[model samples]
Target: MSPYYVSYKSDGTLVSGPGSITAIGNQTGASSYNNRTSGYLWCPTARDFTVGSGGNKGTTADLATRTASICYMRGLKERVEIQTSSGAPWQWRRICFRFRGNIYGASGQNSQSGNYQTHIETSNGYRRLLLQFTDTSPAGNQVENALTALIFRGLPGTDDWYDYMNAPLDPTRIDVCYDKTSTISSGNTSGKVFRKNFWMPMNKNLVYDDDEAGGTESSTYYSMHGKQGMGDYYVIDFFKAGLGTTSSDVLVFEPQSTLYWHEK
Candidate 1:
């Protein structure tokens, strides 16, 4: 179970489902797709990143009985939020995940016997998975990534946490940061790497625009896909008092880690 990325079209088409981990960058954006402003886009919604040994998710395993990760989340909050140098915040549909002691399933893309679905919100202006992972050790960043959790507010404290095996009516959000390296020439030598925040950073550069498609491990991604694709990865943290301002705004109903979201 090697951890990999997934993609989808703006219309929510299943372009990269289970077993397509190695084919992420091989599609070679078609000329017709290049000119079009919207169509298929790369998303960062990582499923089955952690699975119980009971068996493939959604089949033999009982998600509620297992612990996908651990984090405290109240429905009243922003799904995803990013702070900046000016202290402005960027928000989106989000869910939270705890990376500490997390047993990442390499075949994270597989555990599922079929298409899995996590955050399914139908009660808001929009829908998304606001994932939150808290690591106080260190921030490991890469030169190239599909997305980067910039620290515009403040650094994480010693204690923080993400997702539970079973998400409730409302999900939580996680914030990941990776801009703390002495030299860009060298590699990020921090705890973020151990947390598995950033993916392969050696040969590929991450782009948010699907049109910027090209790379090896991760290529171009577009948020315009409308919360489609595997659900784009987001950088968020809006609840620490010492760092800056925080909130508990609700976006949509939180998603659960059921067969719909776990196995393939």
Candidate 2:
């Protein structure tokens, strides 16, 4: 059957026609039942990652099963530590993902069967996904620290080392970076939260370049590559050392929400 789109116009007039598909594809911001952007806001929790098909083995199709909680490794110490420009060792203290909707099935805003969720769950096109973060640390002074998120794409029983390292435009991994502010939270923690947003392409043909303004994905740091499919998982990596010069000197990462667009 040919595809059809249904959405309301800016004036609130309900409309459905062959052209509605193009209208939704042109949406620019967050995807909603009303906005009709070819996207969805994914709010994943610790549970979504644990119940998947991988069996928590961190292997080919089992990468999603590698974590018992929202945080990577259940314990951050297992993460590889890297040297920063200042010669101080930096490691990802806490990398995680949280969402209200399920990435599978007809849950939350997903339709039982329609173009909405299926666009992402079973099709390949120009797609994009984003994660929103806000630093709520006591000092809020993690300016030197860079926020990094890794987007891994694959399906259960179908992923392998070859696709992750050698895929053309749609590699199996994508690294997105953002900047942290140096300001301190004021009277209330919410009043001074430093917000950072990172967007990663969900399709191979799309390219996400690092911000040259001393941001994380700068030429001095890493390159961006990767895309997500039916099975998608994201992990945060903290780069730059000495958050506060002590074990407690760590950056707190709370993923506010995840947004994505599946473009035709």
Candidate 3:
């Protein structure tokens, strides 16, 4: 039997239910919906990004499972540390999400903010998923010690027309990097940039390097990969081992593939 589909009207009212709708048509003029509640499903608590922490810090382990109804990361105090494996020591990195949506951030009018969210239209027809960070310590710090969050809104299961079956599964395939030539930079200098020409499959366990090792070219960088047909939410913990540092300025890039999985 075909799965039940639900959606909402533009007026914030529930339009369809389990038995009220069948297949959606062009004239439906309704948003897609999944009958799942919003909350943390995998990681009940925030995973540590520090090395050897035994939590979800790297791409090897599946952090995507802990994704809340909206996936996010929070740093309680100024001492909280997070880093990507490829980042320099004692440097701040930015966290980035690779999904397609109208990007929004809590930091400022720009995209680089301690707290942010993304509204990805799933391959399915539903548009009700919300990924948000509820609590952030040091309420007014904003700069020195700020909390970062990433929210994803989409269908839950893989049965939708554009489910995980066609989405890029490799996490490393989505490259997040620093744009500035120097290691010690501040502000948008460390914003997220995309390298679309350099695309690789994230369906592996080990780190994949597209270019030769130690090459003096942009193509020599390496990335962590993810698995195909996996969960919808993917989380990456950032950690740093220096004092007075926050790794929150990292870029996330994904190769443009012909895979028609992002839209349903």
The candidate maximizing lDDT is 2
Cα deviation of 162, candidate 1, in Å: 24
- Model 2, residue 124: distance off in Å is 28
Q: Give lDDT tens digits, candidate 3, residues 1-264.
A: 111112211111222221111111211111122211111011111112222223322232332222111222221111111222223222222233332211232443322122332112223222221232321222443321222222322332334323211222233333332111113222332432222121112221222222333643112111212332222222222212222223332222111111111100
Top candidate on TM-score is 2
Looking at model 3, report the run of 10 residues with the lowest lDDT sum: 35-44
Report lDDT per candidate: 0.21, 0.23, 0.22
**Candidate 1 versus the native: TM-score?**
0.19
The per-prediction CA RMSD against the true structure, in angstroms, equals: 21.3, 22.4, 23.4
lDDT at 28, model 1: 16
Candidate 2, clashing residue pairs? 43-99, 43-100, 44-98, 44-99, 54-62, 56-65, 56-66, 169-204, 173-226
Off by over 4 Å in 1: 1-45, 48-52, 56-235, 242-264
TM-score, per-candidate, Cα-based = 0.19, 0.21, 0.18
